[model samples]
Target: MSTALVLTHSVTAAEPSADGAPFGLAWGPITKVPRPFKAEHEANLTALFYPHGWDPANGPATAEVILVICRDEGLQQVVWVGLPMSGEALARTRRAIHAEGVRRYGEPGVGGTADSEVWPGGRALLASREAADGNRELVMTAVGPGYAACSETHHAETGHPAGTHMADLIGTGSP
Candidate 1:
């Protein structure tokens, strides 16, 4: 129903990446209006852990109105756009997002979680079922004050791994 959600679905499925630069360099300008959540993060109005995100200088997104791209160690993973609904509304917001993820992606992947502990935000390259006929779709993860979020698409195949990889990569480690 939400355009940004739809965009997230499409973008994650596409798995945008870069050879030697940030994807935003080609995603066009910061002129395009972002979704409410993205706009909030851009203004630092959300619980976003900054320095992980950046707005496009100028092409056209066709991906995310706002995104967090990390090119450290020359390891560029898929470019995914996420929104954090922290504070009092986090749980409810994550539920809505998780429902939406299932609606678009069918079922959760092998290591996916459809429970209350973790909330869906956005994901990609996911499996629908467990068998060989399983589907590779999208998913989302919730983020908050002590808890940071990462694209669950990465963990879908490996089950729930402990520790915070995003934190280590972003220097927000030790959380």
Candidate 2:
């Protein structure tokens, strides 16, 4: 994602900058999203998606894109799931995208697992990961004040294992 894309898609000039919120959705309130999105409630978390399709980003087409919001705490993360791929193509795409993330956010303060790269920031995080089935994804999570609490709540209610949610990386000193 280019800096131009980030600037053009951002919420409003008056709102606090959504440096970590992809597509320019800021980190507060469901109503503030500019695009019409459908919300799916799961435990205390809400997964919001644009049913009518969103404006395309510059790279490979996304099969799915979700913005996760913790109950009442507002937007928490943006997940962009690229279409499934296999073999060398998958590796190449993942590498290219991961490199782009590094260029945009600098070296990650933490995270260099075999299948993923994570960059932690003061208020959010940027990460790229390749799933076992070869699906690649980019995750941008808000890690500010209430994130830890939100992570705890989601884990408790959903029974998701630790580190299952990208936002769980917060407070792990891994960004």
**Winning model by lDDT:** 2
Residue lDDT tens for model 2, 31-149? 76544345566676766564224542223344445556678678765555454566686566556655655665567665544444566454434444455675544433434345567
Relative to the unseen true structure, what is the Cα RMSD of model 1?
14.5
Model 2: what TM-score?
A: 0.59
What is the total number of backbone clashes in candidate 2? 1
Superposition TM-score, candidate 1 onto the true structure: 0.26
lDDT by residue (135-162, candidate 1, tens digit) is 2212222222121222242234334321
Per TM-score, the best of the predicted structures is 2
Model 1, runs deviating above 4 Å: 1-88, 109-175
C-alpha lDDT values of all predictions: 0.28, 0.48
> Global lDDT for candidate 1?
0.28
